[model samples]
Target: MPNLRCCSSSSLSLPAESYIYQLCAAGPASLAAISSDNSLRRFDRSSLALLPDGLVKETHAAGVSSLCAAGDGLLATCGKDGTVKLWDARRAGAVAVFQADKGMPLLSLACNASSHSIVAGTELVKPDAFVLFWDTRSPGKTCRQYVESHNDDVTEIQFHPSRPSVLLSGSTDGLVNIYDTTVPEEEDALVQVVKHSSIHHAGFMQDKAVYALSHDEMFSIHPVTSADEDDSHADEVKAVEFGDVRPVLKAEYVVQVLVDAAGSYVASGRTSDRSLSLTPLVHTPEFHFEQSNSWMLPGAHGEEVVRSVLFDSESRTVYTCGEDGHVRLWKEEPASSAELSSIRPTKQRKEKGYKPY
Candidate 1:
């Protein structure tokens, strides 16, 4: 990967001092973000200027917890208020709300445009937790819900990049469950489960392989046989466990393993040196991280945790948001003759995989 350098930084003036929680490419030229201040806003992707009619204050009664692209230039956000709202960036307020029968805080969300579907995972409420589904065409009522797969708050939910009905959910209960939503029965819906510890982020990476990152930084990748079918069993799927990534990445914490146009990259931060590293996940021949291919950015957010990282392929720039309440952009530093000569193409090694034990 190219050595990324900080180019520009922008700050969003929310109602109060609040952390920028999530960032997503809203449309062609706009970047959408949600915050702890219970608001949603858009900014120019190039200049990082706040766009006109782009600010929507108090999007949720409490605070927005998650944001995801809902297709057709729309954005979806859910919050402690327990409802999912769809937004058209050109407008000021939510266009529609996906309501749940019981108002429970939602923690994670995922949407599929091809299937006209949206899924939201709720925080554990007494005896039950839920993964509610709604058809984008009809947002007034939830269409389906899975109540038995997870016993704790669902921290992440993602659909197969190409297979919408194939869903993945990870939770505080240390289980990452894969389900075929087309299977109406809750028991039958759950086809696979991978064990972990309090998952912070889990999703479909390249080739639809499932990666689960725990809150304490335990990372692992579970491979699937094929993407065409969703019945792959968890017992058969051996996980390549990389326990406690803080040592491997030489960092204080692992932020997220985000997949962009290129592939999945692990974002990590080292507070002692105040640096951030993006290690590319190479899975072509096998699964491994090319640390030599990592792009390091020093003075990263000044000791604050970076929450989200977005790589724009068109501009070839990196955008990162953090607890510092700022969105910073980084571009490739012009390589010197010595630096250019030192750069050699890295290859994925056929390393042995670790079981999820």
Candidate 2:
């Protein structure tokens, strides 16, 4: 268990109706956030202070839905406007825009630096939903499209942090699909799919597992590789259920799930009286999650939803964004022996089965 406490907080004086939907860390010292007002804002990571003159007014025609920190000081964002735009962290204007067909709203986005590719997931239209890809060097035109990959709107897409050719997508249709982007054909590109009840978000846990959050507030962790190399178990992937099934963190609504950089803990942004809850990946021999911990900022988002959370491993600091249009920073407080003991598992966690290390 780790000590957690809010050290500071800040926000712009936007209309009460404005809400922050997404957050991405540009680097150790800077963060980029997107809001319901169709604006993109930059903040100083340490102070949680809005940078002077660091606002991009109305970057999108509609509310921005997704954002990612693309390498090389670039941030990628997409919106209901059916456009994907990239912004240089050092400037105020967009550097590139990738347009989609009419009525196709971009719902999710991901960028792979090694492959120099940017992918956007679009809303479900009459014909079908699509996963659009573009080469960062040639952004005006789409390089390829994966049609019929998802039957419903794609809610999340993420590239494998270390594997350039691998990608993951989660949809409202309750399916988590993995794609081998090197494959040219849409049908052949899909390598695997993990079914859930209704996925709210999905992402790779390092490179070994895919973790998904359901709309029902339940979560599951599945192996990234299929059980059988023969392809017989293609549709029968196994998963370890948590949350509702095991009752790890008592959260009302989980806005986002994040894996710490060191992979020691999994944090969830809980809304409706916003707070950040953490669960230790290490478990006791009884196969139960350790006693979890949570932290709430002093005047935090006041009943608003926490949309996203970012953990800085080097500094051991936490950054969070919420529907209240504020970005808050939290740091670990020195823990006393009694406080430390209370957070540890009643029994020592076995290093044997499913150790995150």
Candidate 3:
């Protein structure tokens, strides 16, 4: 019902119901693409062409659940196989396999800028989940040991782009913890811990909110500055209710959230119609567009579950894919009439079942 339309459409076919678990842009042109559905497949940005380079077989013994690209054409994948693998994307060979706690599946991975060390997080099973720090410098070194971290299944992990020592992770157990890799022995010395729902996605935004996408269309914008610091919390929230909690903005179901480098705009993807809506952080209460573009990519796998959306700020090009095996690329444009839909305000808020405090 939202003003949603595909800016353009292209489709691809795949062998199975491939849910995109991870994505990374290759080369400086950002013209190359890599994704994990059944296996790692490379695609050409122009003409939505499937390139000859692809990992036909699944990355892990079970299935590839996550992926990340490090510098020098290095790639990492983790999944039900309970192992983390490092690969040379250009060479088409695996360099090493880092095993997780026996039987525990690796769900997520984050790489430092150099890609020498990787931080891996595992899915929650029962009593707890763990995050492992791996040294990938020596590919010949066969053995690996995991440092137990977190009280529940680690849902996601991320590394500070400039600082390798700083790491961030969220878990189903409602904990967001920061770790200092420099002190590998200090297992529980968290730089910061947040009590909230499992974080689906997270990234630093203008030294302000740490934007994250939860399971639902819900998006949480956590103010980076402490609540004790009023000078930082400027925007007044409209829809979502918090007991003076300043991190969250509109608590609607959001599949993905990305902030441009300049922090001028935030793009949050909506899963329902396969589109992303843009919200301006500078304007606060007035979010300009909702359901901006319908993402359509040909040569996609089955199912159409959107895996990830990567934005090239310089080019304003957006690359996204889902279970529908193919990845779609979109170029950003000004807000069209198709983006402005009627908002009942209070009525829609009530229908959302917002708890009035």
Candidate 4:
């Protein structure tokens, strides 16, 4: 790993109590962010500065729960308001809105440009949770729904990197379900199911393996394949369980996985000394933990929990945002270790009632 130092940061413009939980690469030039303040903001990817007139003060009625890039400079955001909005990065207002039936609160969202569909997972409303899908071309029409798959709140949903018809959903019920979207029936749509913990973040890895990270830091990777694509696959694939990474990395929490062409990297953090590291999982002949190439961020978001991390392979830079309402940029230091110049965070507010939810 190259020696990294904090390079740039956006001004603390968010509500001081807000937590910046989501980040999306809006396009080549900009990145979009959503916080607990129920707003959407954009930053210049190069400078890490908030763009002028790039603030959407009210992107959602309730807390903006998630944000995802919808290809071609468009951004999508979901909320506790049970709605999702699409925006063009150049504009400050949302261009279109999609709502869940009976306004079910949505916690996770995914977009498939290849399939021309938007998928959002809802919090468990009563006895059941749902994954709702909307055709981008028909905003006013009702969405196709997938019910009876997960028993608890659906926390994450993502489209297959190569096959858009294959979608994955993870939930608080300790299950990750892969669905074939072309099938309309709920039972028929369900393809593969992997038992896991209460999933905090789960999705496809570069090696076509499925990774499930639980809220309590339990992490595991499982091989996945659709029946039609590979019917000879095992009925129940075993996982390479890396349980409770907090102890393994000496971290207070595991943020999220950032997967790029290089490999799949897990972003883990320790708040005690305010450190973060992106350690790649080597998946060639088999999965292996590689600590030698672990990229370390010495003062990640100070004592705040890092909610989102982004690595740009082309520029070789890393971006992070946290509960402290700060978005920071990091890059390799050019000078010797003695000449390192990572900036210190500003004095934080009293933690009387702060929570890293």
List TM-score per model, in order. 0.90, 0.85, 0.72, 0.91
Deviation (Å) of 156 in candidate 4: 0.2
Q: On a 0 to 100 scale, what is the lDDT of residue 83 in model 3?
A: 80
**Local distance difference test, per candidate?**
0.78, 0.71, 0.52, 0.80
Candidate no. 2 TM-score = 0.85
Q: In model 4, which residue pairs have backbone atoms overlapping below 3 Å?
A: none
Tens-place lDDT digits, model 1, residues 1-357 = 456678778886665456788899899888988876777889998888888888888888877889999899999999888899999866667899988777888989999999999999989997888888999888787999999888899889998877677889889889999887878898987878888899888987644478889888889988744334444543444568889888888888777886755566788887667788887777545567778778787788786667788877556677888777888888778772223222222331011121111
Ranking by TM-score: 4, 1, 2, 3
1-357 in candidate 3: lDDT tens per residue?
Answer: 222223443434455544444457655643333344447665555555655664546677777777777667666777777887776646666777777666578777787756477777777666667777667775432233334556676777887545566677876566666666555364544555655665666555444445554443344455443323353433533222122111232313333555545333443333344444444444235332322222222222232345566656564455766545556666533453332212111111113221100
lDDT of 4 by residue, 1-357 (tens): 555889888754887678788788978888888887778888898887778887888888877888999877788998988998899866657888898989899999999877789999999999889999998888843478888898799999999887788899999899999988888798988988989888888998743578998988889988886757664433344468888887777777888887766567888888778899887776544655667667789989888778899888777778899888889989887774421112111110324222224
Name the runs in model 2 displaced over 4 angstroms: 1-3, 226-238, 243-247, 268-274, 283-288, 292-300, 334-357
* Higher-scoring candidate on TM-score, 2 or 3: 2
